[model samples]
Target: MSQQPAPRQGPIRRIAGDWHVIPGWLPVPDLGVLPVNAFLLAGPEPMLVDTGLAALSDAFVAALAARIDPADLRYIWLSHTDADHIGNLDRILDLAPNARVVTNFLGAGKMQLLGKGDPARLHLLQPGEVFEVGGHRLHQVRPPYYDAPETMGFFDPVDRAYFAADAFGALLPAEAASVDEIAAETLRDGLVGWSSVDAPWLAHMDQPTLGRMLSGLERLAPEHLLSGHLPDARGLAPLTSVIRHAYARGTTDAVPPETIRQIETLLTRS
Candidate 1:
């Protein structure tokens, strides 16, 4: 008999040089809010990172248009075929007639299976291929863990920013303009908690292998770490550290009761 709260769009803000974030928040009944974000690279060759939530399609489009003309977009970098990431793919492709959907082979195939995207407009990338756009070279870097197999993260050489797709996402107690606003303890709890639910197989992953992947990202030393479900962050160290420590001995005993409750609530709602 009770109505659920609708997801709301947050103010659009710049993360760095030409990267702007279009943020939205989804309310979790007994838990806190989860941030859902899409990014825009307003440059000579404009590109969009994700399409944001379908529930906020109008607001997302309006927010994007305010920054750059939809038709001016050169590429739509889909992180994966997850609903939140590709919710507005069809709508965006329709609006951006000249734009191409930049994705991997599997990603393109997944789009076909969903009955979304135009084959003629797809720009598929081979593994280890670097995407060049607007004088920027985007090197594909797979995140340590992901809910979708087709997920593809990237690092921008121009801004030293790493877009980690769904990795490093957290469910915070409140909306934050930046990661600096959340307390260290809260961030750790939230990050580990969200990962447990998002990628449940993480607990079964080989410890040494996971550590090596995290180390590799740390060595990349991105100045800015961008995530789909968290506010803008400065570095990957803080996040990588939290994940490394949490899963050092596996996640079975690491997750807190509150996190379990939150996951249960989410399942029941769905």
Candidate 2:
């Protein structure tokens, strides 16, 4: 008898226009699970925020190819240097040879090597920097982090959109494309385990610092929040409440270890 086929592995949503969210889960080996949500901030040339792992590169490439020229992919920005976020660099480079890699001062030099330091395309970003590319302009603020020296988030002045990288976020990948209520419910359900009184990795975050970060995110009041991993495009006050509480109380709610581990296992092939 033939074996049952595996379930399809791919993105969850395909929204249209200047703002689009392509949500997908990316797996990693050894480290843990990570959700990579590839985005296109459309301008003269759309910006590819973070490339999913090499394993999922084709899905992202194909998605963009259908809407825009794969060659027109002009900017590939790094929120941080964590492997899950940066795993698919080689494959992305292969598809968009002209795309410039952007990141803040801390990882700028390293990103140069990662992007092969193509002088014409490699850009080193400074904290509190302003840049215009592909007809879109953005202001940036690089926050000091536990790992990366200058990991920052970008604010699109025109659109009121904030790309917050890994800061001020939550994961609801499976429920995207559904109504805001459904997505918010899914996000809440997933985080219960981590937000439980006894969360292991919740220890990683420093509550005071996280609170400050949350405050910054509120001040921005972005119409859309484009996170680095696993897009939750649907908007809601409750979801924001969870994220705020998580930071304020230093709760883990399982995303750091469990979800990250599961994603890594599925995305990585032995």
Candidate 3:
């Protein structure tokens, strides 16, 4: 049914040979894993996707050191500007002096406001622009209703991984280390638990925009979707079906109010 291929690298598991989630030793009390699933792009020129946070930097650095030369990090391909996504950005840039910063225009501006991502090293990505890196071609795409205008995600042709920013991301945030467990919790309370807490923006989403977003998502048919906050794949099947239904109903606000009322009732039962 859903792809649960052998844990790619034993208990730890590597989604792609080049990308693996390194577990951290010191997790921030209720903040889940210290470093939220950092992506290690290993090759002649390696890079770190998103650094954890200040609280987790020490352990994160040690983890990075385990499999990398630190200096070998050529660029930090940040997916978004959230703290967990860029917590250790300044420290990492200083550590990996050779590495430049790669993110969309808005993200770069945010980093600059914080006195990070110096202009010379700042790389801005436009939609449809593709670049070559470590034998992989990265194509950028902008998701609708983003927190920032320049919020964009990357699609890698080599590993066929689509870094879909916040789009298709499962959890509201990586507040817990156990992605699988959280995935279960969301279901236990019914599908509404997640949408109620995380998808609040859905109420304001426009029908046309929803159509466009789904259109962009269908293009990737991503095997691996790493979002800004959510990363659990357990909801792959149900979420797909639910999102499809929502899009269809969005066509003209045709989804009757009665249907929504029923959904609210279901939420209460959960």
Candidate 4:
């Protein structure tokens, strides 16, 4: 079996009002490092967006404790059942006894299958339901591309921030404190490379349909874009533009050959 790389935990930092990011990075061998982030909404009703990596459990729990007591958490928003997103679900649940997991029916079912989350503690949201907490109204958003059908992204009206489950994520050459630290071209290439691997369907998607979805997200005009595998982005335009231009004609040429090779390697390994 191939050895997995150890994930490095980053310091907790506040990205917006009452929004703190607990960041970590997983090296992807030759590709680069992928950011694994979990957000904390430190408000009257404290909520955690997603749990950090299980490999970094000690650091993750410590960073979380530094900001607020785990027992004070009111909600644990499960973006999806993906390991990277929910690695510390059970651990966090044990610590945050009062916190209910916010997810859709499908997500809850997946959790049950994994024997992780408690069904009684799940707060399932129906389609198109607005989750109101701590003076923030969160509207469910379906990202243009995703690896899992259960993925649930959201937009917070109060902070004008959009949490994109796995969309707009990029594999960077190094750990960046913020998106501004990376060069534009490098960021673009990284975004394309990561998306091509994570959501290969993007290359085969209908141009018009995909265009409409991206356009609608752009119309939302979110001031802050939070991604599970990216440093906090300042706005939605840049990320949306990268996806738009990459798939303008539904061709694979936009994706680098090396990225395709990497995908093939991953498939073979799987």
lDDT of each: 0.86, 0.56, 0.56, 0.85
- The regions of model 3 sitting more than 4 angstroms off are 1-13, 22-35, 171-199, 206-208, 232-237, 244-270
TM-score of each: 0.93, 0.72, 0.70, 0.92
Candidate that scores best on lDDT: 1
> How many residue pairs clash in each candidate at the backbone level?
0, 10, 1, 0
Estimate candidate 2's alpha-carbon lDDT, on a 0 to 1 scale.
Answer: 0.56
Q: How far is candidate 4 from the true structure (C-alpha RMSD, Å)?
A: 3.1
Question: Can you list the residue pairs that collide in candidate 1?
Answer: none
C-alpha lDDT of residue 66 in model 2: 67
Task: Point out the worst 10-residue segment of candidate 3 by lDDT.
Answer: 4-13
Better of 1 and 3 by TM-score: 1
lDDT of 4 by residue, 1-270 (tens): 988566788888999988889998877767778888999998999999988777788999999998899999999999998877888889999999999999998999999998878999999999999999898899999887788899999998789899998899888889998998999998988888778777878877777878899989988888898898889889988888888888765545545677556544432231
Off by over 4 Å in 2: 1-17, 26-34, 112-120, 142-150, 168-173, 178-185, 189-209, 234-237, 253-270
1-270: candidate 1 lDDT, tens digit per residue: 898777788867898888899998878765588888999988999999988887788988998988888999989999998878887888999899999999989999999998988999999999989999988899999999898888999999889999999899997888888999999999997898788878777788787888999999999989998899888999999999998878876875445667667544543231
**Of candidates 3 and 2, the better by lDDT:** 3
Query: How accurate locally is residue 120 in candidate 4, as Cα lDDT from 0 to 100?
Result: 90
Candidate 3 achieves a global lDDT of: 0.56
